[model samples]
Target: MKKLLFAALAVFAFSFSNAQDEGGSATSQGTWLIEANTGNAMVGSTAFTFTSQDGESVYNLGLDGGYFISDDLAVRVGLGFGGDSAADTNIFSYRLGAKYYLGGEFPIGVDLTGASIKDAQENPLWLGLQGGYAWFITDHIAIEPGLRYNLSLNEDFTDEGVFQFNIGFTLFL
Candidate 1:
């Protein structure tokens, strides 16, 4: 009877230890996040640039990073660049934002975004809001799909608002 009890207790303790090591919440304080996006919104930022396929060539690239300030909260910044070949237009983009994770998975954020266009008189600015779910594929990797809305602060340069769906890849360190 004593041997059986000892074996059971050992197995239970081992299992508990392994479970604890299986990577706690990625949104926990002190974690770092690096992200990229494939969609309209720039990775890690609220900024969006114009892209069109109306017989002209357009390309954009963006990257962003964040550091958790407290449990489930992070401040992020990102930069993006884009150009239209046919129109001979170039855009430089920037974003600054804060994100909060709900229940450690659902993320919501608000940000400020702006773009400077070559030869353009007015720079476009926007206030952005976004929300999404973080689907963790590994201990440190996540795929996030979200919706974002950017309200144009300078409507003279662009539309009143832009709505987009974005998919983001993230690494939590």
Candidate 2:
């Protein structure tokens, strides 16, 4: 986990060297992108928990790939796993969704995803919504900080929702 985080930071840092405007922003049409998030994942009280090596609870990391169908609309899919954490409920997740970028220089986006995780203990079915904004470091890249609210739709779990904070960068091509 630490190594991956370091490598991601290294890449982001080094990407600034000799980078010119790639002319792609969140609101740009027909653009493809890849992104990653490695920050705090705050599990809510009603959330299923994973215990780290230090016996602390945390959520997994996420990676996503997306394409802008139009200047304001994009479709994406993502995966979340490998926190080096152990839990009664192991959640290796897969999610598919779309985001619509609101009007701005660096647009704020609203997203809705249907998420499913592999839970060894029970049925693993869920969905999530996220609200975020992009702060462009370069025309081709941005640092995004976002909040997510996820709820378990399965009957075995409570109806309460979980919130997580994510920080990551997007690379446009």
Candidate 3:
């Protein structure tokens, strides 16, 4: 998983950096954005997990994409797969959301996320809220650092909410 993460980052770094083109605004209407997003890359959270856990080794891989329906407002969708090594469980995750870019830099978003754990009957769902700043490295790429909160909606699955710090790589087109 670590190797895969490193490889993905390398690909993004090389491809995004090399594909730079002059652009107008990243948040304009009809623009599309694709992101490689990870939570707790530097600090906060135990794993890239949406459910509550106590020090379990976990790894997640996900992609998010959005299309601007209007200037500064985008509708997005995401899909992810992860696992808990301790529990020997594989999890499938999904997210649906909207993000509004403030002045095409600061972004605030709300999302619905859920994870289905293998061999478990209960699927945990969460309401996720995040705020971040997009620091554009080029006209078409940005590195986003953010704070996120995942509020667990199902107490029977997970009673506690998750707070995560995230670093994201985005390609704007």
Candidate 4:
């Protein structure tokens, strides 16, 4: 657990440094976010048992930094901590991804992520892909709705994959 926390902190620190070096503003370049999601198993026979009622609710707190590579494109890196009730699970994740502005105040994008979780007595690593659309309500606030599919890579856990529906609010800076 300590190791995982250390690694997550290290990644966030590195991203912060990079954003600073690039002269990124707190509101335009860096963001703090809060997200909530419900996850269900979508594959195999387990699908039948994975209803919204049986699903787990997860909450996450994270930081994201946008590095503009072009007017409509930006590279984004985010790190977060998450918790869920099904198993009283704790997760730490870091994502390196990109976003594209769709000629509006809001932008739509896709992200691929790698995550680690400690649930009950097991620790597992996961790789996931997600896509979302964000509506920038203001210069510092935005709302995003997304979907995620995650595959577990290591053992000490069950559940082969997770299908998640997410809604998040972000405050830039």
Candidate 5:
């Protein structure tokens, strides 16, 4: 997973550098993005070993709106729903970040996110940080890959730490 994330970052880096050399604009400013992600969530501790969930895929359908603060910088916010087999979680994720446009038409950004996931039984909130890169293959389509590290704040699950690797396509409208 780390290797794949690095490779994706390399590709995005190359594309972004090339695009910048050719002079790209903030045309994608105010653009709306819809994305989906699938990955696993691990829960365990040294004292108590919890059974790991298999094929624990999470589907995130989100809408992001971007506002360009500068040619190479933007602020974005997204809201989405995340769910797995055992629970359906509703998440409100807020990111305050900036984007740096790479040469071709691609962009990379890092975000500090606070997310709250609620289910019928418990509500767990997490504070996480993520870095992502988007490779724009076309004006309307892009491939996005990201890495997230989250620490749970719930007392019962305080020891649980999650690392997620995600790759998905984003459609701009």
Candidate 6:
């Protein structure tokens, strides 16, 4: 998990200086955006615990899609897989939501996501909000680093509050 965190940070650092200093407007309406997202929880312990104690890192790989309803607004959906070594758990997660692009030469924005997590014993739901700066490295590619806060709707199989740092790439298609 620590390695995962470091790797993500390294990627962000490597790309940071290369990103154009100029700002850009959001995707235009009718444009399609596809993204590959990777992230894990910001845990207090290292990865080898093999138990849920001291918290565990839960990693996720996902595919996300967005369609601009207008230049400043878009609807999005995602599908993902998640796992944790400490809890010995594997789950399928999905989300549906929207993001309103804050227009600028360099775009920064917030997103509201509603998601579901399902496993063998229980299924839980959460709502998450993320804030980040979108760095357009190219005409069709962007790197987004964001902080997310999730509030669980039920405690049956999850924590009440979850937080994570995420980095993802969006490709305008």
Output the number of the TM-score-best candidate: 3
User: Global lDDT for candidate 1?
Assistant: 0.74
Ranking under lDDT, best-scoring first? 3, 1, 6, 2, 4, 5
Q: Over the stretch 24-119, how does candidate 6's per-residue lDDT look in tens digits?
A: 343777667666655554222111122244676656555777887888677888776656767677656667778766762233333433333344
lDDT of 4 at 85: 71
Residue 68's lDDT within candidate 6 is 79
- Expressed as tens digits, the lDDT of each residue in 48-153 for candidate 3 is 4343458667667678889999998999888888876787988778888999999999999998888777899788888889999999887777888999898988
Per-residue lDDT tens digits for candidate 1, residues 13-112, read 3443323233557778888887766666332232233455778766677777899999999999988888779869888888899989888889898989
Model 4 lDDT per residue over 1-173, tens place: 43664465445444443333334432343443323222343221111112234576545555565665655566777666666677686667676666665653445555555556674455555566666776665444456677766676555565576777755444443
lDDT of each: 0.74, 0.59, 0.77, 0.52, 0.50, 0.59
Stretches of candidate 4 off by over 4 Å are: 1-60, 82-90, 105-108, 117-127, 151-159
TM-scores of the candidates are 0.79, 0.69, 0.82, 0.47, 0.51, 0.65
Candidate 1 Cα misplacement greater than 4 A, ranges: 1-24, 41-54
> Where is model 5 more than 4 Å wrong at Cα?
1-36, 39-60, 83-97, 102-107, 112-122, 151-157
lDDT of 6: 0.59
Q: After superposition, which runs of candidate 6 have C-alpha atoms over 4 Å from their true positions? A: 1-26, 41-59, 83-89, 104-119
Cα lDDT tens digits, model 5, 4-25, are 7546645644454333223333
Alpha carbon deviation, residue 4, candidate 6 (Å): 14
Clashes of 6: 4
Clashing pairs in 1: none
Pick by lDDT: 1 or 2, better one: 1
Q: Quote the positional error of residue 143 for candidate 4 in Å.
A: 1.7
User: Which prediction has more favorable TM-score, 1 or 3?
Assistant: 3
Per-residue lDDT, model 1, residue 118, is: 89
